[model samples]
Target chain A: MPMMLDRRSVLCGGLSALSLAALNAPALAQATRLRMIWWGSQERADRTNKAIAAFKTAKPDITIAGEFAGWSDYWPRLATQVAGRNAPDIIQMDYRYIFEYARRGALAPLDDYLGKGLTIDDFGKPNIESGRIDGKLFGINLGVNSSVVLYDKAAWEKTGVTPPSMGQTWEEFAENTIAFGKKKPKPGYFATADASGLEPSFENYLRQNNKALFSADGQLGYEPADVAAWFKMWQDIRKSGGCVPADVQALDQQNIESNALTTGKAATAFAHSNQFVGYQALNKSKLSLTAYPRVGKSSPSGHYLKPSMLMSVSATSTNPKGAVDFINFLVAKPEGVDLLGVERGVPASTAMRDQLTTKLDDVSKAMVEYIAAITPEVGPLPINPPQGAGELAFVLTRVSQEVAFGRITPEEGGERMVTEAKRTLARK
Target chain B: MALHSEILSKEGRASALRSRGTFRRILERNAAGYIFLLPWLLGFFGLTLGPALASLYLSFTNYDLLQSPDWVGAANYVRILSDDPKFGAAMRVTFTYVVLSVPLKLAFALAVAMAFNRGIKGLTLYRAIFYLPSLLGSSVAIAVLWRQLFASDGLVNMALWQIFGFEGPSWISNPDYALYTLVLLSVWQFGSPMIIFLAGLRQIPTDMYEAAEMDGAGKARQFFKITLPLLTPVIFFNAVIQTIEAFKAFTPAFIISEGTGGPINSTLFYTLYLYQEAFGFFRMGYASALAWILVIIISLFTAFSFLGARYWVHYDE
Candidate 1:
């Protein structure tokens, strides 16, 4: 009797298992799940989620799991994920890191999927080529951005000082800043945040002098004397009270919210054009954008329309086709483009740009206009920075601070900076 | 009778078989206990020992996380000791923090513990309230709060301006004062050591104090001569543990400086530097070397502490 019952139960179990598999087959076959990760603010995360929801509604068969982190935490997390061979299907990459990741084979080359699944034919040659490393496409340009001087128009007007113009020299800008500082709009407020430590601002200064932060061969493009001269200019400005004090400048944690301009310690800040909206939101006064100061009257603008960030598929992704389709949706499709807006910077595609122009808010409109105003003066994009370029940037900030605090002279700071930069680049 | 005799014969045969092999006898004796210890054994080997051994191997190689490691011998260690300036900066910062913060924290903890031992009203409530900071001190939120409090326009500065008409610099952002603010933070979270001190205070007999008082000893005399000597072991314990913790401090400095270990690397703790190398710069091999160096330093400190304790730590022998 026991044997008979056992056999009966086994048969029943087999039949139930068959039915369960039959029920799950359609769901399993249709769901091509993908994971995408990016780093940005809460506002960016919300916009990204809305775009993801829209994509889900359009493609009911594919599901995407989105993850986001702040910029400081993003790279470490991504590096760990890639090292563990469990990288997300889609990654939001930075210009400084794209070369490293692509060269190391952590990212998939998107050239094969270009016409078939990834439609970026309208993204212009330079914009598309910005993502290439060693002649192979590795990332897709999500938007275009350039560094700018963002200042409070009201603050400058109150001081009766002329605001910085589009093509002003660094000397003229420094004079105006000192003039504003003399007015003393607030007890502790300075005209500008100290930009000596800022990497982008330094890079722009280098380019105006016809030197770059790095050569095409991944070596220092400028000498220690160039760095010392740059540091001396800022030091003179700092001495004349044209910029915030060293301690006050240190409070800015390289974010829009913590910036000296936003915190009311200074009237102006050095930032990328994409950050104008965030800075405006944080400040009580109206903020405006102008080009970074040039070296002289006939110097290059030292600005280029580079990708603010890019979307790439990981090399180890199981569903590269699906990831490409989603990326195409983000960069090319109207619905995705409309939702993202200019948060990541101006959209790369002309069609998407035209569509969003009518709907953009005033702050985003200012960013677009600023980019347009400087388009004719902008220079060609420099090569992607070398692998240890990130550490070199921090080295600059450290040495800059030492100079700012009067702990070391600009010449010593410059020498130290070069030694450290060379040592960092020489490692592996 | 026949069944009992058969059972006895079986037991005698099993004992004879067990006595034939020491390994089998040992396993047989503690099989159930070993089964119960399996989870902890697995964790120690898989989680702790395994990774520790791997890091040891990686320390001698040039591992950049993306590529496979190449053997580099003791080059990383040599660079750290001789060539790296940041390593020196980090060591100075960490040692200053440990030396300044540990004794201050322990003194604060002992003072509070003694106050509680006097059987004050709401002793438990005060203990809980004071202990709260330790629970939250190492957390990221508290570190961020510390940043806000020490900011140029933050509450502390606001209070100073309102009361003293003084404009203070940003404490956490100035190289001259950044490490000291961290020391203050370390001193503020003295709750765990306070609780341990309280337990030790309770263990001391009241008769000694009573006898001292009967002998016309004043309160200060009683404290120095009786209470302190008796509490030496507890003080010694707290000192060693707190010193080790201070040496390993990372979060407050990381959050306060926003991970640059600036202004001018004044707040660069050794572990923070290690993290920057491993995660920020992806120099895993060099970071592993840093980790091993830290282990050696900490071990040496601990060994010296134990050896030195014989002179100060009084026991009831």
Candidate 2:
């Protein structure tokens, strides 16, 4: 019986070895593969594939698969993939969602990799700290973006209003917009793009008022009156004929490519510094960036340095180290910066930024120089707002629409916004 | 030896009888068929049943997807029903949408179906064309197209200006008109109900029409007395289903309003609001409660339909 058992064992082992050899045939035939996912336009996609071809030349052992989408569709797709635990090893993460993903054990902490000298720090303290959450770093800033005013240079020049200087007050800006709007023909043009909704408009207002969206403990940073007053500013702007109706502005957000500003209907549009790449990719017109007008000459109140976007490794990833290496490459490698261009933002790392800046076209270079020239009255880096932040944005938009349409008095809208905002905060 | 053989035969017969009895018992036990349903039973237990039960349990707790669910008894339900103004507003919006849109859609569908029932030329092509909107209406492309048509500078405004010398407000962006646009969309896709009515109209016996004509009934009289009475069952079915669908409408409002339910959340339907609570706010407990409330509302409406059927629905049986 013992002799028979030995013979059977040896025969089974030989057969299993043959089966294993068959499985390895496909792996031997194929190149080593990695997947990367990002959000961008066609131009960025073309550039990315070009960079992938470059990477393949350097490391013949590796090949990459790419997935891309527009800005509106990107985050939701990434979030769904993360939830399903089938995330791409490389992810394009945004700052607002970074803390939430990291805190929930969805992101791999990158401290060990950073300690191995894989981080870029000379960009500024604020730029690097925005990537850190709860003493653990989950993602690296892909680029640096501050909100800026994007104006059609030709349109402004045509209207005979010189572009406002960086230090102009909000009052001065509004007055100039009103004067400029009067020269445009019906249905083809307006002055400033409509304020997106109350919260974004209020974010600027709060900056002017020296307030933030939340306190250190994540509470409402201002009273309902603050909401109403801010919403009223939009009303005032629209009423003063310096802005388009709420409907037209609302459409701008739905399709930035089709936005009135891009179509030359409006002279000015509000955008993150990163958005110039998308506009330039689609439109023929030359565009330029300026700061949010300084309220006073001494008002240290311009846009803050924000995490343009970040790349985080999923906690459930099988290859955490590989994910970290890839993220480090995305932020710190010249090739990665060249591939991404200004789609993410201007590169946060000084070395990578300098390497990519020469390759950028005229519009992108304008954005980079605009950020460099700002006098840096930047606000505190944005934290992930409370859990109900999306709801907060929706409610703010609703009330702002009411104010814009004259359906609700600004005071009434404010009271309503406070009630809803508090309710959202309580749930959080 | 012969006696021994006979005894063995008798023992074999007794054993066979016992086996037969067991088979009979299985045949008599109704649940024996459940073994054949094992695959569905497993899926229901693993997927649908588990989540349905879990959602009910979660309705009493505070749950965000990232964190472990925390028990809070009836706190979420209480807050949603009493303290939350959005909840009340959402309910009103949903109710108004269902009540206003369902009957109008059904009536239009029946009218179209009647027109199509005549021996019209190119009947199949016309039917396909009429039904195409229903098939495509829920698609993201159609929703985007709707946004473009109703936007301030959209095709509709262009037409209004070209024809009437006046520019129209943005139908999708204006709060007063956003809900109406959704209703118009619902009405536009009335093909499913129209098809059902066409099928019902075919089921009515031609002899009844002949008999009604012999009894001196006019076309209108024949429709009221015979065709309408016979079509009640189909009408009732479509009504119940369409009402439930209207109550849960989301996409047009979501896409057209850009998920804000603007211009002042006047187009904020209940399910959209519920989704906002669940996914956007991460208030899973509250969303669960809201979902259960929807289930109750739908069930009550369904039950009311069944109760009302005795008076209006005429089954061929």
lDDT of each: 0.91, 0.76
Candidate 2 falls in which docking quality class?
A: acceptable
Candidate 2 segments whose C-alpha is farther than 4 A from its true place: A1-22, A25-37, A42-77, A196-198, A263-265, A375-387, B1-47
State the RMSD for candidate 2. 6.4
Question: What ranges in model 1 sit over 4 Å off?
Answer: A1-26, B1-17, B20-39
For A1-428, candidate 2 gives per-residue lDDT tens digits of 54566888999999999999999988866765667788777876887787677667766756667799876567556665665567777676777667667777777777777646466766567777888888787777878888777787777778887676677887788788888878765554788777647355567667777777777787888787777777766677788788887766656553567567875668787777778778776667777778877556777664788877887777766566655655665677787667767776888878888888889878788888887876356777756577556567777777777777777888898898888788777865
Query: How many angstroms is residue B128 displaced in model 2 relative to the true structure, after the best TM-score fit?
Result: 1.5
TM-scores for the candidates: 0.94, 0.88
Model 2's chain A TM-score stands at 0.88
> What does the lDDT read for residue B57 in candidate 1?
96
TM-scores of chain A across the candidates, in order, are 0.95, 0.88
Best by TM-score: 1
